[model samples]
Target: MGNIYAGVDLGGTTVKLGLLTDEASLIRKWEIPTRKDDGGKQVIPDIAASIKKNMEEEGIRFSELAGAGLGVPGPIRQDGYLEVCVNIGPGMRDMNPVKDLSGLLGGIPVKGGNDANVAALGEMWQGGGKGYRDVVAVTLGTGVGGGVILDGHIVAGSKGMGGEIGHMVMDWDWKEAEVCNCGNRGCLEQIASATGIARHARIFMRESDRPSVLRDLQRVTARDVFDAAKAGDGLAEDVADYCMMYLARAMAYVSQVVDPEIFVIGGGVSRAGQYLLDLIKEHYDPLIKLTRGKAKLALARLGNDAGIYGAAKMVIDEREK
Candidate 1:
């Protein structure tokens, strides 16, 4: 056999792993529970054990493996170290996972990157943005996440904050804006994320006695609002429009800076499908008049698997060099 690569998408609840050939063909993929106890100290060991076990089952020796790459949830310093992964555990703060994980895995080459950034790279490499070198990936999950790829490389920035499109300020005056987890008010994430979408729906229902199908549900989800809007609920439509407006505005700002060829929309809320893309483009087109029709907007193809593909791609690229 030639060489194999391992990709690891390390999330707060689960650690997703993928074994891929040097040619980027994924042979096997699996997941393991993320043990957050002991400040996430067991996470690395568990990941190492899992990779080894899987390799053994495949009858591939460790020597045939090329390298491993990890996608972390928190900010990654330029030195291949994570500043602090709050969702994973407190003990993982300022940890050098790239170096430690490599040691555990018998010193095979290793690389690491931010989860969102790696996801963007994945989409650019083998997913929605496959043909595009300059791409921006936006994930509308519980909170908004983003990754920027310029010339087929991740722009992680000095502090790994380059592609932080979610935290982009949307509400300048903080008027009618709630505080974000980043301790800011008016972030795009506060209005465009799934949590933000649901929050807006609740606010609309509470502020206006608008007869919305969403009013029937005790808990309003982003999907509920989208479904209601699609079902012709005026109130839900307005709420959804409000959310997309902020996302479009943020995209316009991003366009002025990087001018990516396409924007890949991902995450749970993206399940809203083309309707969501239409809403964003409807609002987005008017904002960036000069760059009209230049940047195409589409949905992400890989879904949750994008991260592992991206993580593996990182190692593959290194090996190729």
Candidate 2:
């Protein structure tokens, strides 16, 4: 039998796992509840047990496995050590996940990376950025998250905080912006994320007496705003334009650094589809004066599965080397 690779995407609520062939084709995939009791100490052991059980069920042997890769939610050191994974648990702070996981799997080589970075890798491998090695992936969910890929490898940076595009300060004036989850005001996450969209919608509705279809709904959501804009609601369109402008400006700043060939937009809000891409491009094009061409923008294809695919690809790439 050909060699297979294991991938794990560890989240606070669940741990997603996948088995893939050497070519990065997934053979099977599954998940397990994350036991975060005891400060996430059981997370690694549980992952190890799940992989072993699945391998047994499939009649696969350890010798035929390339190794395992993990996508963690927090910052990771260059040496595969975690600085602190707040979502996982308190015990995960300052621990070497790669070393611990490798030991648990009987010395099987294990690699770990920030979940966003790993997801970016997944997109480059099989999703929107498939043809491009240098790419930037931006996730516009409740909060913003990003990953930077340079020369087909993740730019983890010195503190594994590379590709943290969401936290970029966009507005310095606190009076006009709300504080972000990071305890900062005017972060890109505060203006460009799904939550930010909803927040902007509320502000627009309150500040203006302009008629908006969005006013009919008791609760306003990012989707509601986008749908209303598509229906020609003037206020909704303004809100959408505002959100995209900030996002575009952020990408323009990023271009000065890595200048990726493409920007893959993912996460819940990206479901807005082509309209969102068009809106972003319309705003982004004018901001870049020196770059030869405007950066390409595309929606992420893998959805939630990007992390697992990228995780498996991590191990596969290592084995190939």
Candidate 3:
């Protein structure tokens, strides 16, 4: 067997750890609860201990491993400093994850990046963006998160805010748009995210006399809207189209800047499948005059495993360097 590598996906509720070969094949995976008590100071130590326990159980030696990589839920600077991780706790703010994690793991090399970026790397390595060097990955979940991979490397930017495609303002007029969680008025997150899709459904139901199957449900989701549209509901189609148009517009703007070869859409909302992709493409094609219909769109294949795979890839790439 090749040298083993460790990947950690640190989340607010659980810490997912994976063991993979240098060739990126998954050997085993497990998870532990994230003990957030005492300001989350024990999180890193807990991870280190878990790695040690797993290594012993698997009869693996530290020297036989190729280091580790971490995917954190916040902005990570180029030097491995996490700006702020609200979900983990205030204690993790302004901390050097790579340094602290490596120290805990007996000086083994460690690398870290934003979770979304790491997920993108995973997709590029083994999922939807596989075989593509330059790619854009967007996860349209409760909120929109994205990562830009250029020349097979993550563009983490100076402040680690490089692929913040969600916060891009789509509507400047606050009067007609809802305020985003980021305190902005009409960010793409406000209309293109999963929650945003439901919000649009509510708004359309309130303003129009047209009835939708969505009105029958106590809670409407992005899935319901897409399903209703497939059933040929007029109001649902309108809501779906409106939500997708903003996302398409955002992609068009991103293309003008980075111009990636493909766009991989993931997250809970993306489960709408080919129908959603077609809707976005329908609106996206006309907006871009220069690179019309050049970028390919695909669904994410890795699902929850993407983060760990990306984290493992980070270690593999670092070892190569």
Candidate 4:
């Protein structure tokens, strides 16, 4: 047994905590409901308490920990300050998570980072990006999220918005494009996200007489479109192709800049699996002119646990430093 480390994935609904050895072996993992009372002021304290409780039960002590790391939904500055976490609450805005959590844990060293970026690190450390140093991770869920890892370190950029692949503009004209939550028009998130896939299906069904089983359902999802497309539904097929095409375009654009060795796709929409990868490659292969077919794509191996793993990796890396 080696020194234990703690990792926290703080979300709007739940806080996932994991205890891992210095060797990156997960010893225990658990979750607790996020109490948003008092503007999320209790989140850090609650996490510390949970870790202490669990360590006590496991016959471990705080002194035995190498360090701790926290992953937040919002951007995290280089100094471990959370610029703003809208999903958590207003109180967490402009707070130093590293200091707050460390204070609660008796001055133990703590690290903080953007949740999506940390998830990418987790993938690189033990998931799909394993055995590779330079990697790009794309998460397709309700909205698109991405993280860039080069030389086994996260590229959070100056303001912690480096790997925001979702905001990449796909349509410069804004023609037939919907406004993204980021106030941008024709962002990759507008067309390639899960919500975007379903929206495309709805629009296709409305514009054309092409029949699809999606028409029978009250609501269509990205999964429904993939399933219908696999079953030879022309309408759903079009929708799937459109979404994957845009996603590939985004990846193609990223490849030109970062030139990652591999792309690890994750999140709910990625459940489409090899079918989704094939669709992406079908379009991706044509767009690359220089580094053609160099970047390989793979599915993310660590589902929801990527964040915690990445967080723990942050601590482990810091100890090495």
Candidate 5:
């Protein structure tokens, strides 16, 4: 029964809104499709409307909210401005999310951050790293995104551009990766992302003599590869193995660099379950030279609610400090 707070996770395709108590307890949550075609301009107004509707129907007062914590795809500038969002189109490049949304959201203070960082904070504060201080959270989706929690605080670099692990180089051989949407080439994102997994499977299907059950499906997905691997199909196994190896190598790489107490994996492809985690452990076990047994990888516990929880957490932690 404390002051209510709001957390919004804005993606290219959807916007997830959560209402929470100051204690991070979930009150009510909802999601709506994001209209990316109109550019970043449209999302703010839609969010404002949603908040207004919720106030009328749910009896939540806007003034009771301490602030709103927001998560958006792409790099965020320090003032909660959008620096780049490939999935949402180029219009977000110079968009000021805090300025726009605050105007629409009824003068509530807004703390903006990169989606991955928010998700990481979500996990750290109430999900996987609840009792821990140091952790690294990664989302394996259409593209890879990462967040680093160091010494109990979210690590936002000078301009809020910190903790972008997907851009880390995993393959020097690919040499100047294929120019990612972020304008970087040869990023681990091109290999470890969900889309990357599907892309890899597509190429394997074309060249490999290995037969796949996915051949008949209109589109082969990371899930299809997992299903195929379960069915004993070699092509599926190959794709799974390749993705796992890349993930494992990446985990090993992170272990060497961050040496966090845990590595939490979430996102669409993460549902692949043990097939993915086991592979990461398999590689992480042998290659990591930092310590004999200091780090462990765990699945993210919050699911989709982490963002809202993390958002509310921002207020609670800030007050404590």
Candidate 6:
């Protein structure tokens, strides 16, 4: 009685798996180490093994499996191939992921998309973004990733590469380029990513001769900067403010295109909570098209599980559709 669906989030370090019931209730969840050296081959085998192991451990049968969805951290081609995933490895790029993974799963229908997009889908279907007609979700991890939903459906653009608000150029004159994996420069991602925040702190700490109350370390993290900002360190506050300014501009630009009613923020940096949200709202209003300032903001409730739920939604919807 194929009553269960599966969702897998393939990241650089780990693969998160979730077994969900027909009604979208999560049944079981676990993680597996990612084998980056084996390229895409290990991914499918690992995913298959995880699914089989979970079914056996939980006493479920293959006959009860419905479908599987995957959230892969890379630019997925319109036809469902992995075009590039710098976080993983080379050669896996431009590979037909959907075909390969489905084959590895014994022809089980497998659907795949960018990790961030699927994560947003997960939140919309089961987490904070639920019950909303239009929503945009951004996961503030090592780099910024985004997904857009319109009227209860995911919006994949003509190229199937939509919802890329992270690449929205906020400051054309800045000329500061970090070189994204996408081969672009001076992108908003370079400014608002977790790495950006930490880099900002490092730059500040270096230029000042005064000893920072923050423990002088070789490298400061985004969380450390947030803590310093909360503690009223002038340098940290300035850096955080810069991040807020860029984030606001990026959100405003996205709103102009997607016009989503709610913007749901997730990821490790988002844990900064109202402090971060408040700063974003402060600048978001001024940067937005005056006519489009009505969009609201919200925090993601699902945390890391969003990718799995989203992946499940992808497979289940395909099966039911």
Query: Clash pairs of candidate 1?
Result: none
- Total clashing pairs in model 6: 0
Off by over 4 Å in 3: 176-178
Tens-digit lDDT string for candidate 2 (1-321): 247888899887999999988687888899999898999999999999999999889888867776899999999976898988988788799989889988988887788999999999999999999999999999999889999999888998998989999999888776564567778889999888889999999988899899988999998999999999988899999999998998999999999898999999999999999999999999998989995687899999999889999988887787677
For residues 230-307, write the lDDT of model 4, one tens digit per residue. 889989999999889989999988999989999999999999999999999899988988854568999999999999
lDDT of 3 by residue, 1-321 (tens): 237889899988999999998788898889989989987888999998998898888888767667899999899987799889989897788888888999988787788999999999999999999999999999999899999999999888999998999999987776455577678888988888999899989999999888778999999998899999989999999999998998999998889999999999999998999999999989988888874356889999998888899998988898888
Q: How many clashing residue pairs appear in each of the predictions shown?
A: 0, 0, 0, 0, 2, 0
TM-score of 2: 0.97
Q: Residue 39 in candidate 6 has what lDDT?
A: 61
Ranking by lDDT: 1, 4, 2, 3, 6, 5
lDDT per residue as tens, model 5, 141-226: 87888888888777778777778888876777774326777666667788778888887888888877666788888998888888
Worst ten in a row by lDDT for model 2? 173-182
Candidate 2 deviant stretches above 4 angstroms: none
Q: Between the candidate structures 1 and 3, which one is better when assessed by lDDT?
A: 1
lDDT of 3 at 163: 91
Worst 10 residues of 4 by lDDT: 285-294
Candidate 5 error regions (>4 Å): 35-38, 89-91, 103-107, 175-178, 215-218
Off by over 4 Å in 4: 176-178
Q: Cα lDDT of model 2 overall?
A: 0.90
> lDDT per residue, candidate 1, 1-321, as tens digits?
247889999999999999988666989999999999999999999999999999999888878888998999999965688888989887688889888889998888889999999999999999989999999999999889999999988888898898999999998998765678899899999999999999988888889886878988989999999999999999999999999998999999999999999999999999999999999999988888784365899899998899989999888887777
lDDT of 4 at 149: 93
Off by over 4 Å in 6: 175-178, 207-212, 215-218
Positional deviation of 137 in candidate 3, in angstroms?
0.3
lDDT of 5 at 33: 82
